[model samples]
Target chain A: MSRIKAVDILAGGFVVLIGVLAIVESTSFDMGTSRRIGPGYFPFYVGVLMVLLGLVIAVENLWTRTASDFGWSLPPMRSPFLILAAVAAFAVMIERFGMFPSIFVAVFLGSLADTNTSIWQKLTISVAVPAVCVAIFKYGLSLNVDVIRWRP
Target chain B: MSDFASNLALGFSVAFSWQAMWYCFVGVTLGTFIGVLPGIGALAAIALLLPLTFGMEPAHALIMLAGIYYGSNYGGSTASILLNLPGTPSSAVTCIEGYPMSQQGRAGVALFMTAIASFIGSICGMLIMAIFSPPIAALAFSFSAPEFFSLMVLGMVAASTLASGSPIKGLAMIGLGLILGMVGRDLYSGLLRFSYGVDQLYEGLPLVAVALGIFGLPEVIKNAGQITGRTVEARSISFASMWPTRDDWRRSWGAMFRGTGLGSFFGALPGTGGLLASFMSYATERRVAKDPSRFGKGAIEGIAGPEAANNAAVQTAFIPTLTLGIPGDIVMAIMLGALTIHGIQPGVSVINNHPDLFWGLLVSFLFGNLMLLILNIPLIGLWVRILAIPYWVLYPFIIAFICIGVYSVSNSVVDLYVLMFFGVLGILMNILRFEPAPLVLGLILGPMLEENLRRSLTLYRGSYTVFLTRPISALFIGIAVLILAWTIYGMFRARARRRAALAAGGE
Candidate 1:
């Protein structure tokens, strides 16, 4: 059995990986002297610091016992995915379909995350949200995007 | 005194204009509306409105935005008191005592006192801003690249440690934010760091989109169907019942004043802001109370203290933002972004370059607070009704609004993708129990930090010792080192205590 707190180790390892990536990428830039510091200097040092900190965090459980549970439980993925999907749908369809359909699709997908709302309720929200958005963003604010774009 | 009078006169002349006053009214009304609604914050509201200000004069746009910022501080307390929902992060402390007071049928009184406390705090904070800002700006004029770099370093340190969560995690988030901020082309080398072939990212990520995604979207996701409709009891909120008892009055005044003082101190400090101030005020009030047991069960001091502190902090947060070109909080960062969008560079020279903008904004706070007091008191019923709107209805609108808000910023689909990216990131951070506030401070200050670091190094002819040798820079670095050392000590002590407890449990 792993005595290490899985959450801490995973989070810390992720940080270390990001820092390593930053260091690796930064080496491509000029490593000028301190007097005339290059673009890589600040990021390189920052990455090194991040790696050190991440290492300490990863190993912290060895020195001290944490009250937090040792086991790792995945966060409920349903709502997070649905919410991101809603936003992604809007982003993908917004330029092509314009404001109305994009927002309707976004709201419909977003409303599904609730799980308590009926299909009828979701449909109502989809229609109502787009209408309000059109009034506010299109008419009231006069945003530059087309209401129903068919072309780029 | 005469100079002060003349400055006030000029400020009044600019802020009292019909256009400025009208927009101020509109901003505060909208601010109060959103502030009463749960799961949405001033950051999202301000970002949503940023695009609409495109056609207005910079000063008027700023005055209105500032009104919304402080006004939300006032309005946020309403949700905390009435429904146990914090409208904004700063108001989270208000729910501790305010909700209990409401449950005991003192809801009206709590609302009334919060408004009064908010008024007092805003007035004091505005006065401090007026009195100290000129000298502060003058002092900032002498600061060079070394001093700025040290100051930013101190700021990042203070922000990461003082924010809610583990200090190490906060620091990690700051590092992550700095990396994200480096996505655009380096100013000196003109080499793109992390754009990954996306042309829209050449200027870096949009601040509005990132903020909304991180702060706003996660909130909606968490509370999607969780918030049901809440009904406010009629007898609990009559206008006649809103008056505080004699004991309530006696207990609250000192707490309000103490809260104001604490708030002004913390708000003026770079990186710390209203959220920390409010929590500190609540803690202080509980510590000093005659019977601490009254605290969680309807203590008037709890509501009075935090409400006052948050409002004061909101006003004084501008001190660093306008004077030093550094934001004191996330909202101030967005406001600074707004100034940049309007073609005004925020720094010490802002006072000298645009006296009207600085002075007028300060003066407008007086009117904004007065308007909020009226809006909160006589019109309390309207906001109470607003609380009854179901989360299902409210959140869908929020999602739609967020999508439109992000899309409108630069009219770019890529920014929308960035918004979605940060939204997922925000949810992940939440699961990991990381605070998002310091990350924002890091993101906004990252470029400035890099710029100052390079400038300082170049100026000193590659001498690393210049940082320690310079008096002001040395002072800032020393303070940062002291804070870091103290935090580490505290962490070790806590760990030791926890280990001792575990040993005792094992036995």
Candidate 2:
């Protein structure tokens, strides 16, 4: 199969899985009648619609050939992972270490995502970003968060 | 006339306040800053800044946010003209002619004309809003649950079909969004539907976290290291050289007016926005031009028309948002979300309840456009410099801001986790070629859709025919049906054409 077809199948399969899950979860609720619809009514109907749509999308490639390149190319994982990690770090550290240190750590980690940056450039950005953030969020915006806290 | 004059007086008085004016300035300046940069759109910018508005009055907050919406429209064309990068999605059409114009060293003229076009579009759209909104609001006042339900259905259908990409994928995304929106407590049954043991989700997903994760994170990931290292030459823009020639002016004036008209029509539609309006304007301009060959080669009308269309769409988008309480686009959805957060309900009654908000916002559009015109023309150098800022320096701060912004919303760690989750989902959606805009719309409108559905059914004693019985509701549903049928027909025709081509090639 072509790469584009593979992508379509994968996407359609994922959507179908979500639909099945929704349908299964919704069945646990009372499936009330059309008159006094239960909580499951909307989810159940929407799930069925989703399943139909997914099937159609999956089979669409069989009948029609498209010239546009829909080939799956791997996105650079480094930046996405590191940026996500940076967010996670801030989430984990903000309460324990406080805003300033958490922000500094997050910026430092995020700055590493760009492989093109020099160590000195990363360091400068890490320091500069947090300082400006502290000025803006803490001093300027007056957000009710601790700038620095040693206690967990 | 007297009532109109009095309303205008009230609007001017409220909008002219020092506090309102300052925030307007702040919002437009920040909007221009982000709009000049590629990748970060007004949706993401509004999501990022939503946390900061917690302290302000809802009226001022809305004015500022409204300023950002249209200000970004003005600023979005800059990068399109100079770098072939559309600063916002609506500006994508501008890049066709704009980049060519820049290549021919008419970048300054293109920038000037876009600003002027944007100004004219915004003014015309705002006037239409002022003149027409009252009647529209009055008409919407009679709409009940059935009408609302039908309107939302039409909106979803329109949004999915009209948006760029396959209609099927768009529908699937909307379905997914509707499912995701079911994560909170069920209002009718008092049962928590999908919260999975987390009490933080009782109020449903944190919109800021979801938006930032879905829109902002993916952007930061995609553009990392790409935006930096390019320097815009400062010598390119001379104030005296920015003026367009007489011939350019003559061609652009009519195009701008026509663009505004197209934008106003599309913008006032509940589901569509500036992106559709801009593309339509571009298509219309191309069709009407005496020599269509000049379009992709620095045609002034190409830039003027679409820029005007987008700006006009930005202004008129508020019509449905404020009157009908249905958002005209994703940004308006967020704006409505902001209104809800501030304990203000948006709908027909909003005009009656808060004339100051409705009128003041209208007046602010006038002032904000004036401010944007000044900011865009003379200070082009500052924005160009902003474009030169390295991504390594920029994305980190964006990361920090996203983290803090999400955290500030509820002071909950769960929201941060939600942000991370949506970020991953967003990247996955990107890979699958799904448009996130419809999903966001679905998420915003999902609960409302369900509420109205249940209410209408209950009111009519479970009769499904109530939807078709009401004239307005029936009209909306009929339109939805027609659009869906037309789209399916188009899809089938295209498929048949493709098959024929394939068979011919084989023979």
Report the number of the highest-DockQ candidate: 2
Predicted candidate 2 versus true structure: per-residue lDDT over B1-507, tens digit per residue? 999999999999989999999989988998998898887889999999998898899889999988888888888899888888899999999999999988888888999999999999999999999998988888888999999999999988999988888788889988998988888888888777777788879889999999999999999988887676666766648888889999999999989999999999999898899999999999999999999988788999999999999999988989988988888988998998899888888767788788999999999998898999999999887887777776677788889889999999989989999999999999998888888998998888899899899999889999999999999999999999999999888888888998788799996
Report clash pairs, candidate 1.
A35-B462
Best by TM-score: 2
The per-model DockQ list reads 0.70, 0.76
| Steric clash pairs (candidate 2) | none
The 0-to-1 C-alpha lDDT of every candidate, in the order given, reads: 0.87, 0.89
Model 1: runs farther than 4 Å from truth? A1-4, A61-72, B234-236
Give TM per candidate: 0.97, 0.98
Relative to the true structure, candidate 2 has a C-alpha RMSD (angstroms) of 1.3
What does the lDDT read for residue B81 in candidate 2? 86
